[model samples]
Target chain A: MTRLGRSAGRRPSSGFGDAPEVVVEHAGFFSHLVTRSTGRALRMEIEARLARARGAAVAVLDLTHVVMIDYACADEIVAKIVERTGQGGARRVLALLRGVSEHTREPIQRALARRGLAACAEGTGGRGMLLGEIRDRENRAWEEVTRLGRAGTARTTEAVARRLGTGDRQATEALETLTARGLIFGDGSHYVSVAVMARADTSTASADDE
Target chain B: MSRVLSVSPELDHQAFEALVAELPDATRSGVSILFDASAVTWVSPYGLIGLLALGREVEQRTGKRPMLEPPRNREVSGYMERMEFWPAAQNVFQLPGKQARRHGDSGALIEITSIRSNEDVHAVVKKVGEGARRILQGRLGYSKASVIHFSIMLSEVCQNIVEHAGSLGWACAQTYRWQRRLGREVAVLAVMDVGIGFEQSLGARNASTGSAAALEAAVLRGESRFKDRGRGHGLQAIRRQVLEWHGSLRIRSGAAMVGDIAEWERRLAAGAGGEYAPDRVSVKTGLPPFPGAQVMIVLPAAEESITPGPEAA
Candidate 1:
C-alpha cells in the first residue's frame, strides 16, 4: 500500500483538527490478496497519516484501483483497525472502505459478521451505517431505508418496487421479509424506517429474544 | 494408556475408514486412542481434514482430548508445520506445539486449517484464493474471472463450518493432474466437521427433511435454518459456481451422500449453451450414516472461458 493521495481540511461541522483523509492505493496483487504482512504494512501507513490529524473522521480505504481483497487481508487490515475505537484508544477514526468490486466486499462482510463487529460501509447515494452493529436493533430496517432517502419518507411498496424494478407485490414481500429479519419496520399497509426507529426501545435488550 | 492408530502414507478417505474400523476394538479395551502420523509422508485435503472430524468423534466416545504422536519423518513433520496443521490441531484438541514451519506454494495442497470463527474462514479463503490463482489460473490457464469464482466458492463452502457446525471443523485443498477422466488437472477441496449433523441442525426447521433431503435442500434450494431468506446462499453459490465451471460437487452428510459430477463430454458438446440436464448430475441416498458433513468440490482444468461470468448465453 502506497500513499496515492489525501484530503487537506476538516469537515465544517465536527471540527476536530484538520481531519485530513488518507487515501491508500494498493500496488500489485499476490493476485490481489492483502496478506498478513501487506495488511500490517497498509495499516501502519494509514495510522501514520491519521496520527497527523486529530479527532475522528472517516478513514476511506480507497480500493478504486485494487482489483481484489481476500479474507485474511481484510481481517488484518480493516477489521483489526476498525476494532480499535471507543473508551480511551489512541484515536477514533471511522473506517469507510470503498469497495472496488464484490470480491472485496464479500470477504469483509463475512469477516465483520464473524468477529461480531459492525462496520459502516459506503452505500449508494452517499448513505451508510454499521451493517452488523445494528443487527440486534429491531427498527434498523426502517432507519436504513429512511437513510436511503431515494426510497422516500414512507418507503411504500410501490416506491420500493419501482426503485428495485420489481412488481409491487414483490416489493411488499421484500419489505415483509426485511420486517421478519427485524431489519425494517412494516405495519402491513405502510412502512417507516428511520435512525431512531431502528434503535431498540431498550438498547441493551436483544430484539430477537422477543 | 493410549491405543495408537498409525496413519498410512496416503491419508485419504481409505485411511480414515481403516482408522474407524479399529475404533470399536480400541474402545472395548477401555483406553484412549492417539493418532500416530509419524509414518504419513503424503497427505491430501480429505485426509488432513478428516483427521479433525475423526478426532472430534473419538473425543465424544471416550471423553478425552485427541492426541497425536509427531511425525518421525522430517518431511512429514515439516509439511505439518508449514501447513499450520500442528497449530490448528493443538487449538482444536488442546495439545502442545513445536516451533512453526512455513508452508510453500509449490505443492497443490492448501494447508489444513481450523474454522472455529469467521476469522478463520477468512484466512483459509485467502490461502485458497491464492491456490486458485496459482493452480487454476496460472498453471491451468483458466480465465481471471473463473479463478475468482473458485475463491468465492471456497469462501461459501468453508463458511458453513463456522455458521452451521456447532463445534470446530477443518478445511484443506489440493490440485493435481486428473489423468484418467478429464485428462487434465483437477483441484480437490475437502471440508469436514463433527457436530449435530444436518438432520439434527436444520432438519426440524425444514420439516424433518431427514439427513439426505436436508443436504439436497441446502445445496439445491439454498435452505437456511433461519426463516430469514437472506441467510442460506452459501450452498447455492457453490452449486452455481461449480456448475458454471463444469465441476463436480459431492456433499455427504448423515445417512446419505449426494454428488453432481458434471459429464465432461456433454459439457464439451453442449459448448456455450450450458443447459441444465438431469443426467449430468447425480444424487445418491442411504450412504451409511456419517457424523456431520463432508463437502468436496472438484474443478477440472479447462481452457480459457469465452463467457466471463457464471451465467450462460
Candidate 2:
C-alpha cells in the first residue's frame, strides 16, 4: 500500500509488498494532512516502532513536508518525543518536523525543555549529543512504566507498589492517574495494557548512529 | 477473584493502607476505587489526607486516575464539602445521577413511576441499577465493584419504597440537570411518592415522634423497629453505602426534611430540633397537601486512587 493509502485503510495495490515502512506525506492544512482517527493511529504506530527499536543508536521522525496541526495530535506527538527521549541509554530521536506552526511548536519546545532535547532545532544538520541523552532517558522511563505494569500483579495495590518501587499510597495514586489517562484497564484482579496513542507516520530520512 | 474487604467503623490510616496493600499490582495500577463514605458520618483531616495521598500515589505509578463515588449520607458529603474536597472529587470523577447535570441548566426530563408492591421492589432496584451502571460506566469507566456498590444502594432505596410507602401508592423518579459553578458534572436523582410520607412512616411505630428522629434512627445500624419484619434495615444500609461512596442524600416528608445530615445537624445545634416535628416515623408523610416523601440523591463520580512516594514524610 502507498503510505497515505495504508493509513486510510486501503490494501496494498502492487510491488509495495516489501516496503515494511509506512509513510504519509503532509498537505498544507491540518484537516487535509491529518484526520482525527488517522492522527491517533499514526501516533500509536510511531511509539510502537520506537519501542521495538530496542537499543538502536538513533530514531528519526521525519515530518519535513507540508503541514498544519491540531492540538490533540500535537500534544500526543510531543508527549511521545519527550517520553522516548527521556529514557537513559536508549536510541536518540531526531525529529525532521517542518512547517510547524508557532502555536504548535512552542508547546513541543517546552515539553522537550526538561529533557535536554530543546537545543536540537529542526534541520540542525548533523547529530547532537544532548538530544540523544534526553531521548534515551525518556524512552527508558516509558519502558519502565510499561514493563512494571505488565509484570506487576493486577489484583492488589501492594504488588503494583513493589514493581514501581513505591509505597502503597503512591502505587494506588499512580494507578488512578493511569486510569484517567486511558493507558490501562482492569478486571477484578488484574490490569490489561492498552495501545499507546499514535499520530501520523512520515517519510524516513537517513538512519543516524550517534 | 472477588475478594471482599469489610471495613469497620474504626478504619484508621494504617488499616486502610494495609487493605490497599493487599490488592494485586495490576489491580492496584488499573482498578478504579469507589469510596462509600455514607457510613462514615465524620472523618478527621489526617485520615482524609492519608486517603488522598494514597490516591495520588496510584496516579503517579499507573498514570491512570480513580473515580470517587459520592456518599449518599448527607453528613459525609457535608464533611467532604467542608474540606473543599467535594468539588475536586466531583471534577475528577464526574459524579453520576442528579449531580451530573450542569448546574442551573436543565436537560432531558425522565419520570420514574415505582409500582408499590413489595415483590416489585427487586425489579425496580434492578432497573435503576442497570440504568445507573450504564450512566456511570459511560462517564467514569468504573470497575465492577463500583457498579455493584451502586446497585446495592439503589436496591436498598427501592426496598424502602416497597416497605414504607403504604404498599399501594406509586413513587416517581425524576432526572434533572443543573450547572455547577466549578464546571464539575452533576446529575440529580429525585424519587418521590404520593404515599404515607416520612411522618406517617415513623408515626406508625410511635404516635408522638417526628421525621428527624425516625430518619436518625433509620440510619443508625440496627435501629429498625421492623428488624424482625424485614423492612427498616434497607434505609440504614443505603445510608451506610452512600456515605462510603461520597454521595449526598436529601429526604422531604410533609413539612419535615429529615435525611440531610448537614442541615439536620445545623438545625439541631441552632435549637430548631423541637420546632420541626412530624407526626410519624415512616418513610412517607400522610399530610394532605403534600402527602408523600421525596428522596433526592446526589452521587459524585468514582474516586481516583493516589500512591504517595516512600519519601513523602
Best by TM-score: 1
Residue runs of model 1 more than 4 Å from their true location after superposition: A1-210, B1-9, B17-30, B36-41, B67-78, B91-100, B103-109, B127-131, B180-182, B265-278, B303-313
What 10-residue stretch in candidate 2 chain A is worst by lDDT?
A: A201-210
In model 2, what lDDT does residue B132 have? 53
Cα error of candidate 2 at position B260, Å: 4.1
Q: Model 2 over residues B50-150: C-alpha lDDT tens digits? A: 34433433444446554445555675555445444443344233345444222331111222333456445445444554455555565545555454455
Predicted structure with the largest lDDT when compared to the true one: 1
Write model 1 residue lDDT over A62-172, tens digit each, in one string: 555555565546666666655543212213444555443545666677555655555555443344444543332222433435544223223455556666666767666
Candidate 1's TM-score reads 0.57
lDDT of 1 by residue, B214-287 (tens): 87777777677877433565676677677777677888787677776666644553564675444644567765
**Interface RMSD, candidates in the order listed:** 7.8, 24.3
TM-score of chain A, predicted model 2, versus the true chain A, to 2 decimals:
0.35
Query: Which stretches of candidate 2 lie above 4 Å from their native place?
Result: A1-210, B1-111, B167-178, B220-222, B227-231, B260-289, B303-313
Global lDDT scores for all candidate models:
0.60, 0.40
Could you report the DockQ of all the candidates, in the order they appear? 0.06, 0.01
